[model samples]
Target: MLELKEITKIIGDKIILRNFSLALAPGESVAVIGPNGAGKSTFFKLAAGLMQPTSGEILLNGEQIKKKTHLLKKRIGYLGHESFLYSALTPLENLRFYGKLYKVKNIEEKGMELLKAVGLHYFKDIPIRSFSRGMIQRLAIARVLLTEPDFLLLDEPHTGLDQEAVSLLNLLIKERQEKGIAILLISHDFEQVIQVCERVLILNKGRVVEDKSIDHQRGLMPFKNWYEAAVSGK
Candidate 1:
């Protein structure tokens, strides 16, 4: 489980996140949605331990995350909009490199299997420089999977994906949740969120203004409506 206790982040004179708190359990997937500058990405970075909150605690599996920083990294995987892949390296090589970094045993075999699962096996030997944005995203996902993380944090995961890629990603997300992985996905796609995430947290002005299940808020305006509201500072 992951827990955030009254997390508050301040940058200069602005408060990006204020007294934000939430808990995520195993076998659960959540979508963080809001308009631009809602601090959704900032929240992800905090959970992934890339940044610290000004006044709060983030705990993983009952342990204070900061105290077990190294162990926490092993249990959580994060992917942002950036591909984070070596452009000169083949897909397989990239996966292998990340697997090794994670200390995964039999990196080659595991990398191959992961690439195959993400539908990148055929292009395993092709350098990432030749891959499209969507293909590279798939490969990036594969790299994270190789670590067998207990939690996943993805920012703008569907940004450049096509319909087919979106379908595959949805399938994989369901599969991962079934495997007991807790996932936090930040995105602007409300329909996609409704399809996969059982719950959502809406951030605005660096604060979580609404936290509820999709079913609970079904009667409200559609996601696009909510997005416009947040971005436009409504």
Candidate 2:
């Protein structure tokens, strides 16, 4: 479980986020949609323990996550615009490094499983610098899963993925949700996102404007309507 309490972020005279708050429980997946500069990534960074919030706190379980590096590493997995991979290292080497960091028991087997799942098995020995954007994204995704954290903060995770990779990502999300993994998804692909996330949070100007359940029964119309209406209202 994760909770954000009255979170605020300010730099200079500009307020990046204003009283933003959220609570996520096991097996819950929430998708956040907002225009650029809505503080979505900032929220993810704060939740992932990448950056400390200027006000309030982010709590994992019952404890504040500030300065709790080990707990954060064990409980939260984050994938943002940055790949966070070493360009000089091969996919296998990169995975091995993370495996050591997480103290993964079966690093070899786990790395192979992940590489195959992400369609990178054949390229395991290729340095990350030689990979395409989509390939880099795939490896980054694998890296995130290596830890199998309780919560996932994925910001624009589908940015450079192809349809096949997109489907794989969706399947991964579905599998995680089924196993009680909490997910915070940020994506523009509403059709694909609705299939994985049960709820949607519409944010505007760093504040949540709408919070509602997604109706996947109707396919994409419900989300399209909701998003269009929300943006038009502003």
Candidate 3:
């Protein structure tokens, strides 16, 4: 459902992404892992139509993303590292607002469902300013799901969450995958990556250094193992 052909991005004199290509089919979950400053965010921005690539092309659903930018926005859900919620707005109010923006049918019903899904139902009446970081993140997640998009882009989704929250997110990921949502996860949590992603792509210096599939029975390996292997060219 998503494809990139030799995508490259340059800022001033520095090239962030160079000749990077990736394709994700519907219903597949891929994890994108890399060291800091490896251009992972740049790649996601290019795919999400937030930033244009200096070279190459990005396609979503067989059409050029640049040409169908507005249409594609409706089909993508992006959860950034920070929870972009209005501090003064209650969780219900926030979801209701975004639901209207997305033109979601039965806005109130869907809002309630989403709030419940993210474990924010009881806090629906509390303003986000009074919420903990984890609560805000749950609201952000609810807003993302309010759109029911086909593709999801997550950047450090586990930030500021405890083990219980992380476990909930894992269940949520599995649920989304069952619904055929294509996920591109960028996270520093190697354990989450190892457990949730079927395919793993490692980035280094603007290029993909490793791309491999984990068999269904397999799980995430230690980050040190991968990092050392990368350095030693194993």
Candidate 4:
């Protein structure tokens, strides 16, 4: 559903990504783990069509992503460092606003459904400024899922979420994965990585240093050990 072909991005003189290539298929989830200067954020932006690559190209459904930003907004669900929500608006109001932008049918019903899924139905009318960090994160997730996006680009999605909230987010991710949504994740939580992703790639210095398919039987320890070693240069 998504492809990044030999992509590279340069900002001023610093190179952020180098010859990065990836293809995501329906129902597959991939995790990217790397150190601070590893360009994971750049990779996510490029894939989401939020940033243009200095070289190479990104494609979605066989079309150049840059040319179809409207399609990108509809097909991609992105949760990034920014919440992209209104602090003064109630959760329902925020959802309704975005739902209208996405042109989702039955906006009110869909807003309530996703709010309930995120355990924020009771706070549906509460203004976002009064919420806690975890509450805001949950509402952000609800906003992302409201459109039933085809591909989810989640960057540290568990941020500020409590244990229960984390589990709830995983449950939602798993459900969507089952329904054939391709997922691309950048995260550090071992359990979240193991539970939802089928493949993990270790990126560093703008390149893929290690890429391995998850072996569910081996458990998180083995993969954790591998990740530690690969990026630690062990």
**Which is the leading candidate under lDDT?**
4
Off by over 4 Å in 4: none
lDDT of 4 by residue, 28-112 (tens): 9999999888999999887777877898988888888776778876899999977789999999999999999889999999888
Poorly placed runs, candidate 2 (over 4 Å): none
Q: lDDT of each model, Cα atoms only?
A: 0.84, 0.86, 0.85, 0.89
Clashes of 3: 1
Q: Model 3, which residues run further than 4 Å from truth?
A: 215-223, 231-234
Which ten-residue region of model 2 has the weakest summed lDDT? 65-74
Candidate 1, 1-234: lDDT as tens digits:
999999999878888888889899998888888877778878888888788789999888788877667777888988889878999999988887888888989998888888888898988888889888889989888887888999988887888999999898889888999999998988777777888888888888778777777774564466667656655666
Candidate 1 Cα outliers beyond 4 Å, as residue runs: 216-234
Candidate 2 vs candidate 4: the lDDT winner is 4
Candidate 3 clashing pairs, residues 3+ apart or interchain: 194-220
RMSD of 2: 1.6
RMSD of each: 2.2, 1.6, 1.6, 1.3
Measured on C-alpha atoms, candidate 1 has an lDDT of 0.84
Could you give me the TM-score of model 2 versus the true structure?
Answer: 0.93
Error of 2 at 176 (Å): 1.8
Q: Which of the predicted structures, 3 or 4, would earn the higher TM-score when compared with the native?
A: 4
The best candidate by TM-score is 4
